[model samples]
Target: MLQLNGCAAGSSSLRLAKDIAENNRGARVLVACVELTIVAFRGPEEDYLHTLVGQASFGDGAGAVIVGADAGVHYPAERPLFEMVSASQTVVPGTDHVLTMRITEAGLDGHILRRELVPVAAENVERCLSDAFGQLGVGVEWNDLFWTVHPGLRAILDHIDKALRLEPGKLAASRTVLREYGNMLGATIIFVLDEQRRRMEEDGEGGEWGVMMGFGPGFTIETMVLHATSNLRKK
Candidate 1:
C-alpha cells in the first residue's frame, strides 16, 4: 500500500504500478484513491461563480485496483479491471498561475474556473498525450485510444475535445461523470477509469488502446496509455 494523493494523483498511482510490475517479480499493489472535494471546499464563499462551477460539477468518489506481475495463472473474471500502459506528467513553461488552490480561514479556497484554464489544459493535454503515446512503442493514434479524462470542468473537457478534434463522444465517460457526479479532484480520474471498465464489461468490448488524462495545480498535465494484459478478445 502506498499513498499518491493530489489532483492528478491517479496518474502517479498508475506509474508506480507500472514500475512495480516491470521491476519486481510477484509484486502486487493495491492503489486506492478517494476524494472528498465537496467537503474540502465547503463554505459560503464558494458562492462565487469561480467556486460554484467546481462545486456543481464535483462529488465524492473512491476507487481502487490491484496490480500484480504477469504469470500464467489468472483470475476468471474475464480480464483485469484496468491495465495501465504508462503515466507521465507535464507542467507547461509558466502556466502555473492559471490553476491553483489555497487554504484560508474561509476553508479551502480555489482559484480555478478561470477562462485561461481551458486553453492551457487543452494545450498541455495534447503535448502530454503525444509524449505518452510515444512511450507505448505502438503505431497508435490519439483517436485510436479510449479516453478516460478527469472531468475537471464541462467547458474544459469540451475545449479538449474540440482542440484535439477527438471523435464525437470520445470523452463520454468524463462528461457523463461530470453531469452526474461532478469533479472529485484527484479522485475523479479513478472514477473515470472505473467507468471505462464498467462500460467495456457491459458492452462486451475488448481493446487495449486507451489514454487517461488528468489536469490539476501547477497547471500540470498527467496522462497514461492503457493496454490490455492479454488479448482480451483472445482470452
Candidate 2:
C-alpha cells in the first residue's frame, strides 16, 4: 500500500513516478489514470465551449502502488483488507480533452460532466472492465468487497453506474467520497481506499476486498483490485 497527493495541476503522472522512486524505492509500482471525455454537449453553446476550454488545459496527475518482495510491517489483530490481485488500464484515442480540470483565477475548477461522456464511456467501459478482470484471471462476480472508483462528478458516477450496471450500494463509497471531497485527482482513489480501510475497522471486518479506479487525461482509465489487511492502523 502507498499514499499520494495530486494537488498540483498537470503534474500528477510525474509526481507519482517521483514519489514511487523516492519512497517505494525499487519496488514494482502500478500506475493508473482516469480521463474524462464528452458524451454530449448541451445548454448555452458558449457556456459549453467555456467548459470544454477549461477542461482542455487540464494536466495529468499520477498515482502508484508499490508491490514486491517486501513483507513490510503489520498491524496487531487486524486482517489484510484486500490483496491487489490484478491491475489494468485502457486509452480511448481521439477523445482527448473531453474532460479536464484547470487552475483558474478563483482556484482549480473541474469540468467533467459532458453530455458525450455517457455514451463514449459506455462503449469503452466493458472492454476496460474485461481487461481488468481478465488480467487477474478472475471474474467480476468474484469480487466481494467495495469499489473505490474516482467519482469525477455526480453525472460521471451515474454514467459509470449505468455502464457497469452495478447494484444499488455497489458504488456508495465512491459516491460518498466524491460528494464530500470533490475530485482529488490522483489522490482520490487513495482517499477512497483509506475510507474503506476505516469502514472495515469500524465494522471489525477482516479480509476485505476493494477495487480502485480512476480516469484522467489522454482519455485513460486505470483500475486496480486490492485486498486490505485488518491489521492496518487508522492512518
Q: Judged by TM-score, which candidate is best?
A: 1
Q: Residue by residue across 99-196, what tens digits does model 2's lDDT show?
A: 55455444444454468655666677667767776776765452354676766656767777777776676777777777676665565666566666
Worst 10 residues of 2 by lDDT: 2-11
Instruction: Score each candidate by Cα lDDT.
Output: 0.71, 0.55
* CA displacement after TM-score superposition, residue 56 of candidate 2 (Å): 16
Reference-based TM-score of each model: 0.82, 0.62
Q: lDDT by residue for model 1 over 60-133, one digit each (tens)?
A: 78877777656434434434555665667787778767777776566566676468888888866777777777
Alpha-carbon runs more than 4 Å astray in model 1: 1-6, 41-57, 71-79, 230-235
| Model 1 lowest lDDT segment of ten | 71-80
lDDT against true structure, model 2: 0.55
lDDT of 1 at 78: 35
Q: What lDDT score is found at residue 33 in candidate 1?
A: 77
